[model samples]
Target chain A: MIRHPHLRLGALLLTACLLTSAAPLAAHAVGGSDAAFVAATRGPAPGPFLYLGAKHMVTGLDHLLFLLGVIFFLWRARDILIYVTLFSLGHSLTLLLGVGLGIGLNSWLVDAAIGLSVVYKAFDNLSGFPALGLPRPDPKLAVLGFGLVHGAGLATRIIDLGLNPDGMIANLLAFNVGVELGQATALALVLGPLLLWRRHPSFLRFAGAANFAMMTAGFVLIGQNLAGYWLTTGAG
Target chain B: MTEAIQPMSARRMAWLLGGATALAALITLGAVLPAEFNRDPLGIGKATGIAALWAPDEVRIDPAAGQQPAASAQGGPIRTLEIAIPLGPGGDPAGKDQLEYKVRLPRGGAMLYSWQAEGAKVADDFYAEFHGHTLAEHGKMTVAEYRKVSETANSGALTAPFAGIHGWYFLNTSERPVTVHLKVTGFFDPVAPGAPGNEAGLTARVGSF
Candidate 1:
């Protein structure tokens, strides 16, 4: 059973892989009964929007991938807080301004950028900079920038939903708060096992493989989103 | 032990990137492309069979082709048929409960149509859809939905989107009996009640939205 640690990591990665593959079928947007709610609803619905936001974060493989990559190697609680807060701040900014001011961006393009962000995180985790003979990027600034891009991705989805401006601010704030809460819950689940796993001697041996697998998942995500872009818009 | 601090060789980095890229490409070909666009390349799609996941549902054509008018070339009296469809018990919310009365219209032909449902006993909303569709040779159907709504009465002008069967679907939402009255004037073929043993064709097909 001592060999099961690698198996556990394999399960985690396989789950991520399956989820990432399945997610591209329907991009991160509202549909089905939720779409009916969004279309039929007449006025303010902070509670439902909050719930949806949390739900989105919970199921959003792209968001979870970036989160996992961000906290992969970090051991310090202070660093985790700082980086997560920065991401939250950046994410909340565009989600507010984009949806509030009715800023519009193409959803697939933003989603493609979000996918590329995952690739970036995975590459960074692998310490690819020195190998590629390039200077490393500052992790904080990188997260903030990608976080902004990620916010635009979220904004693109909400905007595409045709969210009515009535009480839009309240609903958006609720959604952002829900996102943070969901992130915290997900972090707890991921970090506990990860912290435990990091204490093992095999952690170093397997770290490279884990990052490589993550990079593969990210690349596949990018391909899927780009394919979505082409299929839905161009090359018809 | 100190490989983490070592500057990795270009050869090793190439192997890592190449292997990951190959894996990503394989996944995209096998699952992503097929499930999304049904574009199968490696026959992995045939193995996984996710290509059919996004296939467009078809509208079935029963052998009950309605009678064709003699003066179908126009300049004839406006073809009019009135049907009083009685809503049966235990209606289908999936549109199977709707009586689909279809008329074949030539491409670009204009058809004026109207329908109303009486509900003295039932207070439910009257639901119907006006749509036109044509079937391709290999079972692929191209459908253009004109209107779908809940109203007791509706009157509209419909220009045939293509050379195809176009008509109204009257759905009974409640168990209470509702009589649907319909009138149509157009250049088209008639959709008579039943053509032989096909009793199900009497209650034509209304697609669920």
Candidate 2:
């Protein structure tokens, strides 16, 4: 509408590349000063844990990609709120219970499941399931189900860090609150550009191409996680 | 207002799905597997020079991992070093001219060190705090002060209390600039400048004795 649709599309694609390319290039593990902070935390350090939780959610590419896929097509604010709430509810349950009970799954497998959620959402965006003569699952239920996997993935990382058990409840609660804060922040960032882009007719025209790219990203994530699993377990 | 979807033909959808899967597989084999896991099954990553992207610290070789020895009792081979710590103008009592230097020592590893300050008018014109700290855990640091005093020179021997960093925080308190020459013989590694845990950013001079 303004001019130079090709340039706009190129810019959008470039942005996508920058965002998704970082996932493979960077290790998903927590390290650096953050790891030091986690290791050095003693008891009841809610403020720092909260900050860490928020930081993790914001920087997490797997979570971001899944969120993007989940919201790519939804237009109504009410629907967005409902879907996001379901996701929050699902993830919160596992993040709290899994860590509290000291239950852990292989981090790689948990991440692989998270990647599969992205793939599922992207495929649904393309209506690929229906095209295959499969009954489409309720979007709300699917989001919630995948949210549980996402939460478990987060829990695995926290568990790996060996957080102190003293005042665990308060710290975990603070972290959860921080995660929600981070989710809101990330949602705002993602939604703003999406809303602006939706106004352009190019959105509809290139929607398929965009979704295909998302699907590819999802696969890359899955492959990376599975490879991590295979290599770490020495199953190769 | 109409956000209804347009369905692709079954054949088109199948092709796109297959194409996406194939492309993703190619990328994973060519890039992610090599860079993240160090397993380049297809060899394309090596051919394309993508495997070099794997940082040395991040590359984990699993087969020998369990069999590898624990953190070394001594880092590398024994070494001797003579280093200089210097301060320029304004190196005065306001604590402006401060520098920290450290060496990594394994638990119970010993080092004999002698350091002398020159250009200071007297012993009181120079100050140093010799200390050691355990690697931080959970953001909490445990510091052991071996000595904290003001003097122009000191000679000491230390068997490290823990496997961590032991160092000197030197301050030239005289209005005139002062330089301190330090000599050490020991089983220790000079903490590299700008490395993690080298919070002071003081560069080490690696003159062998």
Candidate 3:
């Protein structure tokens, strides 16, 4: 097959981006001292909040890869809006409820589930299970469900801080808003380049390679989180 | 006319998938390898050492009024006493250390007090208070007015100006250990010679103010 040169380059760049970014995400989650430093310095300061929010979105390889898969096949602006809104709503609701109600869960477990979400999306993109003769569940519901788990994972660190109840509700809402803004910013940065690349014929040829990269990233996330679960809780 | 391009064969697709999977597995295994072999708890020895400093060899609590019978120094109404414990030595293992002074309250009277560390950043920055206890069964006082306060009076990363101030207070109920555990995590070097860090131990006693 004759490949579009631009699409091939975009695919290669995407793979490199995913692999390089995935390392730090997995490394810190598995207990790097730097992670502890970041945790300790987190406070109500607007500057720290913004920095943390941006870092969180950028470092989150699973979230970014999932967004890539979601938008890959979408040609219309409206579809992107619909899917991102559904995900945003799902995440916002759980982030508020989980922290406000003090509903704590094992962070490692939640993160592992998040890793599975990445895998699920990649498989869906590849039409893997359907090819094997299994019924595929609705993608929208799956996105929303995974979105809740992702938000819960974000809440774990805040819960560990034992934040003062004074202004906690307000602060949490602010943080959630910041998270959405950061997500929107990342989407623009990533998908703008992606949409342009899709105009090239190579997009079709290299789509599978992109999906393979996403799947690899998902597996890496799973392995890291599972290891953390074992080390911290002695659970799988 | 544009020629239609051929799709990848199923075998090629499988190879791509398999290779990606194997690569991911290897990366993950590599990530986990360091943690698996290095099983030492991150701060276990340090924490144990800190805990050990407060393990009571002996203790005494004197009443300020001197009206009541002298309670056993082992554990009683803690007004004033002498504490001998090792302080920090300059090193990398040192963190932003803190000393926690804990006082168990007597049946009716709960003690309320604060302290300042005389010569150390870790010590001078120490602060605590206790209150609110009514005697329960067995004449054992449960802490009712328990308030934990921290030093917010000073600033600067390299210097602790309030180093030699009082450290902690308590209202003793049971004759258990009125323990003070100082966890040394941070250090400061004086610009002048014969500065503190000259002594390796901290001496601070809790008393009613």
Candidate 4:
């Protein structure tokens, strides 16, 4: 649909830029001063926890990529809201439950699964499953499932931070609220460019390339996490 | 809008998926594995000098090769040590009564120690300095003082900030002779007995190193 060479090049460049920007934020694991702060914090410190939660969501490129894939083809506002609310519900449930229940899984494995979610979403965007004769599950259910996995990953990181038990529920609720706010902010920013791009004739053509890039990033994430598991745990 | 889009051919889809997979493999094997984990599956990381990105050879002075800072938490068995340091002769100068004792500890290693000086007329008569230091280049050392007090008794714990020697220095300024009693228990390796600065012949007991 994009007949002009310059416009096609511009679209390609935009995708490339998006990906490269995501490279530094490859994993959503907290670290450095933020990790120190989390570990040091005790009791109900809602304000800092809220800020940290928002920061995590904004900087989480993996979450953002999956979100991009989820909304790439969605045209109706109501449909978008429905899918997002489902995802948020799933994410929030596991985030609270996993930490509450003290469920400790291998961090690397959880991250790998999160990576798989990205791959799955990108593949779904490309319509790869039905084409391969695989019975495609409901997209809404799939998004919810992936959201659960994402929350598990978040739980793993938070647990690793060694959060004090006192007033943890209040802090967790604040963090969850912050995460939702960050998601909304990110969605607004992404949707603006996406809406403008969709109005152009080239959007459909560029969509495939974009999903392919997301898939590649997912694969890279999987490899990195698996490598981490192998190196740290001495088990494949 | 979704209804108007055409499904791509499986063959073309396969090519794209395969291409993306190959690119990911290339990046992981060539760049990320080496840069992050120092694993060079394809040897590109080694060839391109990226293996050092994870840990530069010169800076990381690990007793065991290839062991990371995270792995340093796997400390050996906990040990205990108690030693008595006798003061110098009554006519000796202020510096003559000073003595030092130290123990080796890996980064993240921890220890609890308490010391008390006997025969000291007042708290100010005894001086103690608790510190840690690592040997730097050219026979120099980098030291960090944890505490300094002119007290007859002190008790505390230390989680080592780095792999180094950590301990105390005691000085008796009183004319009366003083004998310092020290007790230490932790996951640490006591410095070799009778070594320099270990004139008190400090040795650990209660665990096999």
Candidate 5:
């Protein structure tokens, strides 16, 4: 019989938390702001968008946190692929459609929603839904829905900048590609240690604590968004 | 011996998880702890690698008449003004080394002016005046005179009109260092047009060293 020890699970969880949190500090040192590069490009710059997109994804904290939460419970590679695909599909559609359509929403609200998405995922990981007797929302649908909100957030930022449209479509596509690349890179880094740690006996023991920290972070993010909203609009 | 190692009991697992969680929290707290103690304003932090050279002096805008107006037409009457002199290249305070002059206006206006370093690549933009009074009370101030002189096709001198606030944005693109002087005239003397002039002159020296 395959035996899993609580101590082994704890150790695994500890390693995962350390790796995940440290990834951003590492990526930030390499790529500070891809947005600034996109802004600087005057003409049809060669693959500027792709580079910018990758940089943004790598540096974006909210996106990373959400990804971490999604993969936290999944022990199998297939499950990771399935869930991530759902998230990607959801975000990509909104990123392309929202910006392309010129649909605008208050950024603060969108950010707040993004924060809530993190909270939701963390709670779901804790199996809070079954405990509360709530119907389990399809993870795929949830990912897609949240992706739309994320896209809206990106759209709002771009619209605010009044980006010149000369090569905007191409640039945006490049940026999206960059974002995907960055995401893939992050996944690679996260998954390697994760797969190894899962083999350890302590993975399950400390999983709850990591999820709790994520939930706390989610709350902090929501408060930040709400604070931003109040500062901008003077609304509670 | 190929004896299978037994899995930890559920209680033991819980304790292990709890310990890991506590450790994680401690690590995070350690990382963030210093920031709480060393609180600083945004943009003023060291991350940007830039600092303001000269702190802006308080600006005083006085009306030509001895009496301060209740308000002006635009929105409010003009009050005190504050101007900030950002530092320039070579790590020297832009206006600190030079002989600083404080120009007093007739009504109750005051201007704080500074000079830039020689051969410094800095914005020559000077903020003339910032009104602290209410918008409705201060009457609109118009520009009286503006002129410019140039030694070569690319090099030129510019004189801006006397308005509420004026900025001189001159770029020293020349290979040789260029010395440019800016003289701003006019203060808050919101009397009738025919009334005596309450013009005040504020000058700033700028160049590259």
Candidate 6:
């Protein structure tokens, strides 16, 4: 029911914004049921951990929003792959090193940083960064930096879970593999609609509106996490 | 690659920034602040009546939550209470969740307490906080946290610094149901479970040590 010509392309972005925002409230990594399972199980359970990893990525709202922003404007397969690979590399490095070395961060702070990642990507996608007086940052580098923050967010959660020392390496590797698969699956779903919408003539005209919606969602995420951090730490 | 996006009109760009700020402010004040920190200055939360849709990390607690100080338990024996907490998804506890067992103490009373989760290992981890809250002159409550963590079991002692409602707050971050076995030794009163965070009643369940 897109009446105005400008409404057509804006529809998908609006939907994505509304859908992700609504679901994010419940999008944390661990629930009581899952925690019970992890606590009861001993030794290396690579398979279950893999499933958990995939499940986390699939349902992780912050990461998904950032990924959507990443692939939103990309039309070429090669560029998408290159950017995705960079992200994978950055996150993989941090995920493994952060947990492996016992590098800890406050979960709220990490989450807030991830939200900032979304805002950054959406601003970049909308060409908002260029409008500012500052020189434009390299998109690849920005994505890579944000990917590290996103990975650290998950790493902190895992570290809190208290991983078993036995067969930990194998389990971590399997979990990382699961994350890639889940990211790929989500990417396909998000990219398909974007590709289809872009084929329509209304896409170019309304693209600004769509990206702005993304920016709005991203800002909401940042504000929410920041609020959480402030309330918990009592820091104004 | 997206073509260089034609610059948006100044007014439109301003609208984007302004609109996003407004939306974020609205959601924060209406939903997030009330559900998370229970700070609802705007009254929009009570009028609309919605839980926080963005607070996934809030430390969930009993909905009818209030810290009612127990009467003097100066000569009372140790009290043990078994509590069953059905922790919901996410860190935020719902209204009327968690067994907030409290005891009132005079200036210098002490109590020994131990609690453990009974069941399969919980991954989400159970967070228990031993704290005391004192009502000040004008009914303003001030609190001090003694202990908080997501562990399967915890055992320790608490010494009251002042006359107040001192007790333990438990939140299960796990997915399955876990019963918390709590044993208290020393001077304290037994307050009932789920008494709107205030008042006293009979223990919900009593189990042998």
Q: For each candidate, what TM-score against the reference?
A: 0.66, 0.65, 0.54, 0.64, 0.52, 0.63
Candidate 4 local lDDT, B65-139, one digit each (tens): 333354345568878888788887344755568889888888778888999998886887888989877744332
Ranking according to lDDT, highest score first: 4, 2, 1, 6, 3, 5
- What ordering of candidates by TM-score runs from best to worst? 1, 2, 4, 6, 3, 5
Query: Per-residue lDDT tens digits of candidate 6, residues A133-167?
Result: 34779888988988898889877777767777677
Residue-level lDDT of model 2, residues B44-155, one tens digit each, is 8799898877643322122212332333354456678787777764444555487777788886777888898888778778889888776544323456677777888898
Candidate 1 lDDT over A1-236, as tens digits, reads: 26666656665675566445543545667666886776666667878988878877888878888998888878789888988889988888998888888887877778778878887887777878778888978888999999999898888778777777777778778878888888888898889877877877666666777777778877787777777777664311
User: How do the residues B35-87 of candidate 1 rate in per-residue lDDT, one tens digit apiece?
Assistant: 76666778777886677675644664332244344333443345665556666
Determine which window of 10 residues in candidate 5 chain A has minimal summed lDDT.
Answer: A23-32
- Estimate, for each residue in A1-236, the C-alpha lDDT of model 5 and write its tens digit: 57657556556566465434531231121122544655566655547667666666766667778888788767667777887888777777777777777776777677778867877776666665554556769776887788777766666666544445777777666656777788898888778866776566555555665666666555545545554464333211
Of the candidates shown, which would achieve the greatest DockQ relative to the real structure?
Answer: 2
Compute the lDDT of residue B58 as modeled in candidate 1: 65
**Which is better, 2 or 6, measured by TM-score?**
2
Better of 2 and 6 by DockQ: 2
Q: After superposition, how far is residue B194 of candidate 3 from its true place, in Å?
A: 39
Model 5, C-alpha of A119: deviation from truth (Å)? 0.5
Q: Which candidate number maximizes TM-score?
A: 1
TM-score of chain A for the candidates in order shown? 0.90, 0.92, 0.85, 0.93, 0.81, 0.89
Best by lDDT: 4
> Which regions in candidate 3 have their CA more than 4 angstroms from the true location?
A1-7, A27-51, A232-236, B1-19, B35-209
Candidates 1 and 3 compared: the better one by TM-score is 1
Off by over 4 Å in 1: A1-25, A234-236, B1-7, B57-209
Residues B1-209, candidate 3: write the lDDT tens digits: 11112334556546756776787766655543233322223343233342222121121222222343333222233344334332233231442132323222322222222232433344323444532222222212223222444542222111111122112332222222223333211221111222222122334444432
TM-score of 4: 0.64
The worst-scoring run of ten residues by lDDT in candidate 4 chain A lies at A18-27
- What is the TM-score of candidate 5? 0.52
In candidate 6, position A155 carries an lDDT of 78
DockQ for every model, please.
Answer: 0.21, 0.23, 0.11, 0.19, 0.04, 0.19
What interface RMSD, in Å and to 1 decimal, does model 3 have?
A: 9.4
